[model samples]
Target: MIKVMDRLLLFVYSLAVGAASVFAIVMAAGGFDADWLKNAVDDIIGEDALVQTLVIAIGVVLLLLSLRIFIVSFKRSGGQAPSINQRTEHGDIRISVDTVENLALKAASRTRGVKDLKARVRAADSGLQIMIRAFVDGDTPIPALSEEMQKTVSELVQETTGIPVSEVSVYIANVTQAPTTYKSRVE
Candidate 1:
């Protein structure tokens, strides 16, 4: 949810900056007189207490927005890689999440009945949970296939990356049809 809000802020900031840039460019191109803008702002400020208050409020809001964007720019304190970190006596190791997902897919695809496979991995409370969505051959029973796939994926990912896999959820999405081979007879 926080990430979503940050993205929203970024989008709004981008639009705001673009609009300001265009406005400045137009002003520079003599689309409007600088004196006209100064007079308009001066008139608004001199008009009434309410107008002056509104101008101050708008300035404050924009200032706060800019400050927030500046801070969010540095939210990630360091250049952090997208990976899982492991600490050992020698040093530290980082494994890419993509690597783990690929490992899961590789393991699941090796199962006899699976024709096509894709995998997703997410962090769980104790370990990682892998979800495999597969298209399978119609010959095998889904229950046995799913069981085997789950075991295979979990074992392979853990063994390879040393990342504990808590569960592997297999979704047998569809049964794939085999391609037919054409045969010709000579006359």
Candidate 2:
């Protein structure tokens, strides 16, 4: 849907540019004395200085729309906030929940047997609860691996973000295997 909308917008922009280019050519070639060119252009644009004012307004609106989209996309994905108990006024240092999650994910990825880490947080009355989904080796023992992952993620989050982790839940989403290719000999 988004791709279709983008293509449609691009097509409209291209058509507008083509029309403007043609108008510029006509304006230049005919100078100001061409009555037919003047009437044709005016009929299309109308009498309210449409060419200059409308074009400028549309350009400004499009520019602002694109900038807003860019800023939203660049913002962090997770929407979790720290627990009320998690607030820290440790002198001028300011930290956001999104920053903490980013650092914890980075740390979790450093562990052996872990393929990737995606962390999420939930605010609780006691403290903040963390959930870290890790893709790891399937051959490893689930119990031991889960324990290690939980411990590591909790320690990393606490050390890095200064947030107390009441729970560190690990979910193993998938275990990847090496790809195999088939070879055939031509007779």
Candidate 3:
């Protein structure tokens, strides 16, 4: 999944940055006096021209790899809120995707069996599609609840925004028991 890949890339970038920061800090704190590092530096400085060239190439490759990873990790357009454009007689009307999502959430919340609802709205060929993920009560009937949520969301979106809903897909992610309060024995 793209989300998983993005997270993985971000983790790698973080690690690279952390390592570089620690290395720089140690060098600034006079870690260059360490015998191993001193010897390694001396060897590098004393190497033949061909060997120095190869070392420089290897360093360049690593730098380029880190830079590529850093850029990819930070450049993400998916996190930005999207908008839907509609043409009208007077002008163009643009509606925020968040508005559609909020509309769908409100409609779904009105359904009796739905809880912990989240909605994502996207532009579709016909109009818009509403994808909802929700938690339902354990006793709730899935088919009936899904149908109710679909109808409610479709109708509400159309009525409120005049946006035709191509489809309302309800994914029941979880079923949870009602919350109960417990009394402490000491109290």
| Model 1 C-alpha lDDT versus the unseen true structure | 0.86
What does the lDDT read for residue 135 in candidate 2?
A: 84
Candidates' TM-scores? 0.69, 0.47, 0.56
Tens-digit lDDT string for candidate 3 (1-187): 8668757766765776788799989988997778878787777788577768877986786676677666875786576557898899999988899999999999999999776999999898898989999999968789999999999999999899888999999999999788898988994
Q: RMSD of candidate 1 to the true fold?
A: 4.8
Q: Candidate 1 residues 1-187, lDDT tens each?
A: 8778877877877787788899989988999888998887787868678888887887786677788888887777555656878889999998877889899988998899898888888876689989999999899999998999999988989999988999899999999999999899899
**Model 2, residue 28: C-alpha shift (Å):** 42
The list of candidate 1 runs beyond 4 A from truth reads 1-43, 63-81, 185-187
Which residue pairs collide, candidate 2?
none
By lDDT, the candidates rank as 1, 3, 2
- Ranking, TM-score, top scorer first: 1, 3, 2
Tens-digit per-residue lDDT, 54-131, candidate 2: 767988866765665566568775655543344346644445667767766876777677887788877566656778
Cα TM-score of candidate 3:
0.56
Of 2 and 3, which scores higher on lDDT?
A: 3
